[model samples]
Target chain A: MWKSKAKFLFLLPAVVWVLIFTIFPLIYSLRMSFYNVRIGQGDVFVGLNNFARVFTNEQARSAAFITLKIVVIAVAVELVLGLALAILFNRAMPARGLLRTILTMPLFATPIAIGYLFFTIFYEEGGLINGLIPWKVPWLSDPGLAAISISLVDIWQWTPFCFLVFLAALQGLSEELYEAARIEASSGWQVFRHITLPLIQPTIVIVLLLRLAEALKLFDIPFSLTGGGPGTATQVYSLFTYRTGLRFFDLGFASALSYIMLIVVMIIVSLFFRHLRQIYD
Target chain B: MSRKRKRTKGIIILVLAVAAALWAFMPFYWAISTSLRSPLETFTIAGLGIPFIQFRPTLANWIDQLSIGETQRALLNSTIVAVFSAVIALILGIPAAYALARFRFFAIKNKDITVWFLSQRVLPPVVTVIPFFLMMRSASLLDTRTALVLANVTFILPFVVVIMRQTFADLPVELEESALVDGATHFGILRNISLPLAAPAIAATALIILAFTWNEFLFALTLGSRQAVTIPVHMAGAVDTRGVQFWFMAVRALVAMLPPTLLALFAQRYIVRGLTLGALKG
Candidate 1:
């Protein structure tokens, strides 16, 4: 009994921390969503008005769509590129470890730094991309290009993460399967499609889910790069929420916006988990 | 035919790998090169257009940024906040991790607790930022390093707990059992036996947490105004206030990247394992 009590005591600090920081804030934010909160003013209960504003507000709606678009497009491209890199590097090559180390350098870089680096790289006249290419393109000025540019930065920083995960998964694969395929004179494509793909499917799903979650909360890149700028061209959902809550001091509306984001993420994550369970079963 | 085809394929793969490495590393090289260039060189098309080999390198930007008080203060604040928050989280989290790893509890399943902890990490920071902002404001802790530390603890604690829990679980139980038979208390066993065993993992976990806290922008931006501004926040401020000082921005970015990059170089093996939360072995 004492041992069990000691175990509970051991867990107490983390539990209390969660209760105070995470759980309480979640509840408080939920409550704040229903109030008309402004700076230097009392939070007046407004009963669903803030949530309605979230739906009615054009910026918020557009931001939601843009966030989804970036997440999907970026994650998909990253998976393909990362998988290709992983496959290429999975086999023995000279300086393989050194190459991998360099590849992963981007993964640990400060996102804000990446944003600033890319900000310079995508500059209209003096940018690296423009300097390298013949024709001048407005990278951050044009709306479509700005969005693509931001996604590209994300892809650059994160593809290595996917690559590393996939490499690990590939290395873990059994050698016997490949030997059997070789004995049968199976083509490379057929062997890969039948064996490698199925074997690494779980890691693929895990990487996708991780990337989707992180990408959905995208802010630092857009915040630092364009400041959601050239208009609201690159203003993602989190940045929109930030502007609403902190910049504008409309806590009520911001809380609502946050809740909407929360719901969307929760739904997506749960769906992924269900799929993951299905795969296991 | 097969040997020739295989050679061709290998060559193509090698070429592609070289291309991918250049793609990954070019921007970082640009950042360093830009940081080393004089402001005149940075602004002029001739200097900015080409790679580092084409330019007269200078340390003017690095000198200017380091001399600035705000940049120094921000770097100091970042180090303090990151180090302290990581320490605090590890202090509180390690024992809990051990408890979860070793002991089966009455009502709560270990898996449930772990999932709950990880879920805290997954929830978007914006969801928690509003209330935290208000709470800090009311408590008169806003813009203070304490506020940043507390907020960082919220996110990083779970990661520490999760990683350490997995580390503890992977450790063999017989050592602790033998210690118990020797009349060592649970705490004693954890301190003397489990801690030494898990030291490498702990170091890796701490470095990762430090990196996360140092690189964290959203919470720092929201919770800190001036007094607690971190390196990332300082970089953002330079972007906003200074406006396209490419050389200066590059210097700041490089300074900001130093800790995590160095840590990564030292702890690359553990980082791969820690990142995957031990689900995939390095």
Candidate 2:
């Protein structure tokens, strides 16, 4: 009995923290969604009105769609590039350690710095690409190009992350299995298809699932980069929430929008967990 | 020789890897280059469309940002918030980690706790903004270093607990039991035995929390105004205060990146394991 009490005491700080910080905020946001609370004004209940406003508002709908689009594209691109680099580096290679260290350097740079540095690099004529390749690209000015360009910056910083993880997973593979396949006169592609892919599939799933969550919550780069556009072309859901709640101080409506985002993210994360479990089992 | 062929293959891989490294590092290189170049050199190089340095360097921008009272204050605020937050997180988290790793408790599941903690990382900062602001307002903690520290602790604690639990679990428990048999109390066992073994992992965890708090923009942006702004918030404020001198901002940006970057270098080896949260769990 005494041992159990001591153990429960050990759990108190984390429980209290979660209660105050996470669970309380979640419940507070839910309650706020049902009320019409503005900073200067007092709270008044307005049930379902905030949700109605979200569904009917075209701008809100557009922001939701744009957020989904960015998540899908950016995550897909990171997975592919990360997997490829991992494979490339998996080969018996000289300077692999040095290369990895260099590539991972960007992972430590703050998103604000990345956004600022890329802003200069993507400048029309004076940028690095423009100087080297001799063709002017309006990397930030054009609306359609802006989202993709920012996504590229995220990929640059994060792809090395995926590379390192995947490399670790790949190195964990048993060389004896590959040797066995070779002894059986298996072709390289056959060996990779039969042996390597199956072994690394779990890592791939974990990587993609984590990256998807990250991409969906995208804010910093776009916030500092285009500031939600040449127009609203780059407005992710997070930025939309930021603009509504903090910038405009639309607490009630932003709370509703945020709740909607919360539900969507939870659903996606659940699906990702299911996929990960499938790989594991 | 077949061995010679293998060596050439290794050389080719090396060249390819080097190329990828250069591509990955270009923006950071550009940032440093822009920071070091003088205003005249910045414009001259910009006009010529050169990414690399082609002229004399200067420390004018670094001196300007560093010498300014407000910028220095922001840096001090950032240090206070980050250090205090990380320290608080460790204090609260390490014991919790030990409990989770070493014992079973009523209504407490380790995996559930870990997932719950990780999910907290995914919670949009905006979700907590309104409520946390209110909490701070009622407590009269707004625009103070304590507000920043508590707020940072709120975000950082979960990750630390999850990672430290893994770190503690990985350490052999016999060390502690052996101490316990020698009549050492629970606290003493924790202090004398577990801590020394887990120091590397604890330091790594501390560095990550420090980096996150240091670079945190949203909470600092919302909670801090005038009085307790952090370096990132300060850097963002720089956008309006001084219009982009490309060169000047670059230097200030590098200054901002310095501490976390150094921490990353010192803790680089433990980083891979720390980051994945020992996810390659057997």
Candidate 3:
């Protein structure tokens, strides 16, 4: 009995902290979503008005669309590139460790700093890419290119993460399967498609889901690089929320937008957890 | 395969490896080089092509950025909040992690608690940002480092608990059981056996948490106005206050990247595991 009491004491602080800060605020924001909360004014209950506005609000809709677009393109690209890199590194290679360490540098660099660095590199005038090429492409100023540029930044930073995950998964594959496949005269691509891909399918799913969760919440890159501009072209959902709640002082609407985002992410994460359990079991 | 085919594959892999390295390192290299370049060179067309060869290097931008009171204060604030919050998180989380890993006493099972913890970690920061902002404002704690620290703890604590729980779970129970057999209390066993055994993981967790807190932007941006601004928050401000001093921004970017980059290098082995919250076992 005493030991059980002591164990509870050990767990108490973290539980209390999470309840007060995480749970309480989550409930507070969920309630805030149903109200009309302008800055310097008390919130007024509005009965799903803010949630209703999300569907009709053009900026919110576009922001959601742009965020989904980034998640799909960026994650797809990272999946391909990361898988390729992992396959390459899985082989016996000279200086493999050194190359991996170097490749992962961007993964650890501050995102806001990365945003600023890329902002300069993607600058219209005297940018590095423009200097390398004959033509001047508007990397940030042009709307179509701006979205691609932000996704490229996301790809550059997160590809290493996917790479490492896949590499670890690759290394964990059963050697017996590969030996049997080789003895059966299976070609490299055939072996990968039939054997390797199936083995790492769960990992691939987890990485994709994780990347989707992250890319949806991406704020610093777009926030710093383009400030969601040339004209809200790069404004993802998080930035839109920031502008709506803090910049526009429409806390109620921002709360609704965030709740919507939360729902989407919760769906993704629960899927990831389900997949994780299937793999573990 | 033929020797020639094998050689060709090796060369291709080498080339690809080098290309990947350059792709990852080039921007940081450019940023550092640009920071060292004279202002005249930074603005000029000819000086932008390749770094170091085209311009005379200078320390002016670095000196300028460091001399600014706001940047210095921001750096100090970032360090204080990151270290203190991570420490606090470790204190609050380590025991909880050990308990979840070793004990099964309460109505709440370990798996249920873990899921709850992860759900908290997975919730988008934007969801909490508004409520936190309102709460901080009401408490007159807005723009204070304490507020940032508190908000950071809310996120980082969950992560610490998750990672450390995995770490403690992986540790052999024999040592703790033996200690308990010798009449050691639960706290005694944890302090003398588990913690020392788990020290490496604890350090790795701390470093990763520090990196996360150091690079965190939204909470810092929303909660901190001026006095408690972090490096990322300051970098965002540099982007917005727009005479567009590219070199100054470069200098700040380089400075901002240093701590996390160095810490990441130190904790490289555990980074992937840390990132996935031990989901992908090696």
TM-score values for chain B across all models: 0.94, 0.91, 0.95
- Which is the winner by TM-score between candidate 2 and candidate 3? 3
- For every candidate, C-alpha RMSD to the true structure in Å: 2.2, 2.7, 1.8
Which has the greatest lDDT?
A: 3
- lDDT for every model? 0.85, 0.77, 0.87
lDDT of 2 at A158: 83
- Note the residue pairs that clash in candidate 1: none
Off by over 4 Å in 3: A1-3, A276-281, B45-52
Off by over 4 Å in 2: A1-4, A271-281, B1-8, B46-53
For residues B18-51, write the lDDT of model 2, one tens digit per residue: 8889888777777777777777666457433333
Model 1 has a DockQ score of 0.56
TM-score of each: 0.96, 0.93, 0.97
Q: What's the C-alpha lDDT at position B278 in model 1?
A: 47
Better of 2 and 3 by DockQ: 3
Residue A64 displacement in candidate 1 (angstroms) = 0.6
Q: Which pairs in model 3 have colliding backbones?
A: none
